[model samples]
Target: MKSNFKFFLAILSVVFVFTACNKYEEGPMLSVLTKKARLTGDWKVEKRISASGDVQLFQTNEVLKINKSGSFDIFVADSLTRFGTWAFAKEKEYVYFTYKKEGVDNIDEFKIIRLKNKELWMEDTEGVQFNYVPA
Candidate 1:
């Protein structure tokens, strides 16, 4: 029947249109070759950028120290504070910033763009960029 053939064609057209569309990406996007060993060290935040491209630079004395023992410390001027427990999710390419803040309950995950011995770069889920360098 002509009507039956028309229905089949319509279905086929819809399928092809969907297949032709670009694939959608969900969740944090990270580099394919992010390894954990490059993350341990003392780093200072040289610059930070928001998703909208706003930038912030830190003072020289502030630093983030990541030891091989699994804890992270943040130092601002003369004050040293515990930032959180840190772990690398090799499969997801995210650094898990796990902590129990006074009122909040959840782990923060930052997608790493590049991690090297001298520099570390990451972006939050909101796309804010944090660039670090050896302190």
Candidate 2:
């Protein structure tokens, strides 16, 4: 009976550790892949939701590629539109990007709502949510 109680306690502890490790609002529960590995890929917007309603992007095609080297590229209609450096901020809760435009530097950030192997969800400062899938 003592051994059984010990086993139960061990299981409970394991469960707590895994659940506590999840940092995102929407979560994977547990992931073997590191954050950078999971984020390094080509992703396209699957949906966009704003305070008003769902929005349809004007571009026929748009892709955002995040590299393992901390660089990112945004392509619109098969044309390179933006290139930048990206990093995780605020304990990995936000994705921060820096780029140059008109010879000046610009910074943008997105709060991560969910991050998984196949799906990424982020919300902008304007309360717009973007859902991305592997492209």
Candidate 3:
């Protein structure tokens, strides 16, 4: 009876240690909120910087809408209308923006460096980082 009790206690201790270790287990981390359930919401572009070489601050209340189908729409708050339609291409490694009416090919393409907690950092060829916050 004494030997049997000690074996049961040892087994319980092992199980407790394993469960304790898994208690802190977490899921994968994502850079962007790619879920359609959460993406199809209103967002503001906030501010932009022209990173030609130096950081130039461009202030505007621009709004952006990202659809569930990887489609996007951008609007300038001044006119409160769409500036263009943006498509998420190349596994979201690149984005293509095209104006609806102007069609001037005012395309601004950049590589997404990071996305976390509604904050996105995009990098240009010149190594300039554009910080975007959801408005």
Every candidate's lDDT: 0.75, 0.90, 0.57
List ranges where model 1 is wrong by over 4 Å: 1-34, 90-92
lDDT of 2 by residue, 1-135 (tens): 999999999999999999998899999888899888888899999888886887855333899999999999999878999999999999989998899999999989899999999999999989899989998
After superposition, the stretches of candidate 2 with alpha carbons farther than 4 Å from their true spots are 52-59
Q: Roughly what TM-score does model 2 have, to 2 decimal places?
A: 0.92
Error of 3 at 13 (Å): 26
Model 2 gets an lDDT of: 0.90
> How far off is residue 94 in model 2, in Å?
0.8
Candidate 3 contains a number of clashing pairs equal to 2
What local lDDT score does residue 79 receive in model 2, on the 0 to 100 scale? Answer: 92
Clashes of 1: 0
Give the local distance difference test score of model 1: 0.75
lDDT of 1 by residue, 17-76 (tens): 766542212212233433455688888989999999999987778888887778888888
What is candidate 3's lDDT per residue for 1-135, written digit by digit as tens? 999999999999987876654311121143234523333445654444566555656465776766666566766764546555566556655556566556555666756555445655566656666656676
Candidate with more favorable, higher lDDT: 1 or 2: 2
Summed backbone clashes in each candidate are 0, 0, 2
* Model 3 stretches astray by more than 4 angstroms: 1-41, 45-59, 101-106, 125-127
**Which TM-score value belongs to model 3?**
0.50
